[model samples]
Target: MKNVLIVDDERSFLSSVSEGLSAYAAEFNTLTAENGKKAIEILNSTQVDLVVTDLKMPEMDGFELLAYMSRQFPDIPVIVMTAYGTPEIKERVQSMRVSQYLEKPLDFKELVDKIFLELAASSEGYIRGITLPTFLQLVEMERKTCTLKITSKGRIGYLYFNEGQLIGAETETDKGEKAAYEIVCWEDAEIEIESICRRKHRNISTTLGHIIMEGFRLKDEKERAVEKENIIEVGIEETGEVDGEEEIILETLEKEEKMNTLKDILNEFTKLQSVTAVCLVGRDGFLLDSIARTGIDTEMVGAIASSGFGAAESMGRQLGKGELTMSMLEFENGPVMFSPVGENAFLVIVAEKDANLGMIRLKLKKHSHELAAVAAI
Candidate 1:
């Protein structure tokens, strides 16, 4: 039996859905959460097949949860139920890769139908699966405005199309044109589409056809490099008569080197007294790395930052302005600044209320190129 997770602040609605699903859709079991935070906790502990969520809630809303899932559980399809069916909300949800969007006063049976349809389609054979490049081409040909959730290998990617023109793309730790290239190159990808495109500005200026062609070129180059490296490794292993443990040690050492590089960069940000927290968040809204003082929720901060940045960027586009370079949100007690570190990731800086914005921006600008290099690797 499949396990379905439902989230809403209304206890009565939650109870009704849980009981109704059991009675009407006997093939599935249900779990419930009062808000996004609780839903995330349940998701961490339980193995869930599908998520049905409401848009607005206290603490964490549907948008934040959707962003989180796009990174951590891209393979799972989500159905969004919202009382507010505004165009802006629809566009935002689409950009976040929601599987289905339904307005409030939802017909329970219709919701169940969407759930079962998504589950069934995902279970189909390899031949019937949606090919990532082909789907994008079709979207372009049809002039469809929608968001696509793509699962390739172990990563989840999101593609937003405005009237069939590719505008934005995102992955767990990447975004924009680079994310688009990486996503289309992966094999055996599964796709989920929801109509609506919220992104206003175009982060990927390249044509879709060109981007797809480039993706293929990159994939071919990567494969050739890997093959050459593997041949060299095999020859060395034969000559040295190395055991499995030695190979494991070499792999561990390589990983440690990468981690050290990331740590060194994070340490530099933490050294600032005005900075209370520094987090690197992927375009898909996942936390890549973070350093924080005590009493901070780094994961939540990353999620909120990703959403805020995307929304602001979209608004800029809609206004015929250029891409978003940096944004600052000031609260009563503190201020938060967000900036694009690279095409794939962003930096979120939390500082005291009286922190020096000018100095922080200057420092961030100075190290932006170095940070981008680190992020790319």
Candidate 2:
């Protein structure tokens, strides 16, 4: 069980919060305070693993508490729950490196997850540590604009950062987050913090773009394919016999051949002035194979893109809009390609500035139909 501290001015709110957390009764040992002064007194002596504090307290507010923690117990995770937030206060909290932030009328699910993440955070060596809600909320608060890209499984995606929040996203051939979501239908790794985006393009219609990528052209996440150290076994019989079924043999052979051929394509693309690498994923953004020059971690790329695909779909549904279709990504070194294979899959490609966009489009225009037909089979 972990020890926790709750500091708030409102009696009812404090009790309600305590009760909610106590529901997990056995997992956490909770302590409460009516004001920041009492909370500080408790912390000065007792050992508390986490703190759930309200922003505005009568005496000694959340900021004061944050300062206290920073000075004495920086390692202890602190989560700020507030109804109102100002730019100045938000900036101050960011600098403090608060573990997480919660906006009032607390989201129980989000809150629980935040706690879990804080608990799971490694105390020792860590390269990339992500405080989800805080980071995401900061982006929204600041309204910063940028692009965040990620890849996993065998797929890839592009997330558009607007005002420091996830405002939009897409794939190599799609226009918006919605289209990217549908094509890369991965079960996990779908959140924005771990998604994809390159150029942050806004002129294209995301839905149509995803459809075009999957239904019209067969593409893949070539530039970001994870280099597998060991050879993967594609297919085998029940008894580990490869001679049982002709169709199985053909299918296994096809997957391997495609991956190898795709590698060749990526190698050549990297050599071109405006070309990077190319990927051949399914209409659903399921990576079939890929090619790339730079050592891009394709597994992470595929997982992230798949989640982006899902988010795009969820956002579209919330808006009472249609499904996403295709998208694209532009990067400093090269551009990422997205082309659909069929109803359930799509493809992605990475290229440099000099890669012929017109030629790529023409090629996709011709191949997408065939790819979609195959996907249906």
Candidate 3:
């Protein structure tokens, strides 16, 4: 049901591994490549669920391939195999977040078990190293009838899809459309799939694409509400002292308590009537923290902002400009501003077109130092 790509330069080893893993034909449709270059070609053309690759190859070895995957096909998990795996090599490979690493002369049975574990660990299926949308899209493409159990940030929920149609969903307290939207919007959620769909009635009639889009819309609203609460909590607790760390017992409160205080500054900016959204995006295109009104897609905005900023920064360097200080874009509707928050994060502000840019820039300049402290922590 899943496509797995195997890459090895040695013709004999490649043939043997492919032939041996043929037993899993019921679970995976296997594909093979002689080197990383070919493997990338196959990846570009095929929908691969996983990649099992040998480290040393004639051209574009596994390390290079792995690096390429990290940038382009990050959703696909990889299993790295190599005979010359030393501690140094293992450490470097692990940094890339490969699913598994195996030294040469692999145990065939153990390898099979590992593959199955990576695919789906138990009688109940499992999914990791992939986004929820991608996984749901796969389910729809395959016309799967299954119950997807999800756990995220201590909340648990279930989504029931019968023959690729989402029929029902539930959380501990909510059910139907609301629950479905919430479940689908979860990021980095751990998922388990059961092949049976128990719900007989359909609560959702919208197409899957529409549902996903709406789910994201709802997610952004929920995040803003949470941010509002955090803001209120910290605003009232803000002391006249510029330094709050003196009151925080480092040994007792832990780093998390100290680190969260950084966002407290952003909460103050939202008090401005013109500012509609505030987001902190990491360099890797992840939405770290945000506060925005309904109808805003913070996730999409963050990803786009990260990509756009990265490109702009690269362009500046190519033009022989010094490091970029700030990037701003204005439309007829409103103006958006971006500035480096810290080493690895960027601060984004979405404001009304009529908003005072000078005032906002001044506030950002004054508070940017505070933000940097939070980012450092």
Which candidate has the highest TM-score of all? 3
Ranking by lDDT: 1, 3, 2
Off by over 4 Å in 1: 84-98, 125-377
Can you give the lDDT of residue 150 in candidate 2? 37
Whole-model lDDT per candidate: 0.73, 0.55, 0.71
Worst 10 residues of 2 by lDDT: 223-232
Write the residue-wise lDDT of candidate 1 on 1-377 in tens digits.
Answer: 77889999999999887888887466778889999899999999998887888756888766556656655665666776765446643443332222455668878888887778667745652122223564465466446687888886788988889987899998998989999999877776666666678677788988776677678666755764675567557655655746756566566545554566466557766655357998888887899888999999999999988899999899999999998899999999888999998898899999886454554664576567656766776
Residues 214-307 of candidate 3: C-alpha lDDT, one tens digit per residue: 7865665566567656754564466433246534533323345445555555775675536788888888878878888788898988999998
Residue 257 CA error for candidate 2 (Å)?
A: 36
Q: What C-alpha lDDT does candidate 1 achieve relative to the native structure?
A: 0.73
* CA deviation > 4 Å runs, candidate 3: 84-97, 121-377
Count of steric clashes across candidates, in order: 1, 75, 0
Backbone-clash count (model 3): 0
- Tens digits of per-residue lDDT for model 2, 1-377: 67778788888977887888888778777789988789989998898877878756677666446545544565677777865457664443433224566777788888777776666552432212223223334334445454544344555665566544454656666655454444333322223332233454464343322433453233334322322211223344333664657466657665665555445544543433244545555534466555555787654455556666556666777998876655567778656666555566665656665354544554556556545544454
Candidate 1 has what TM-score? 0.36
As a TM-score, model 2 comes out at 0.36
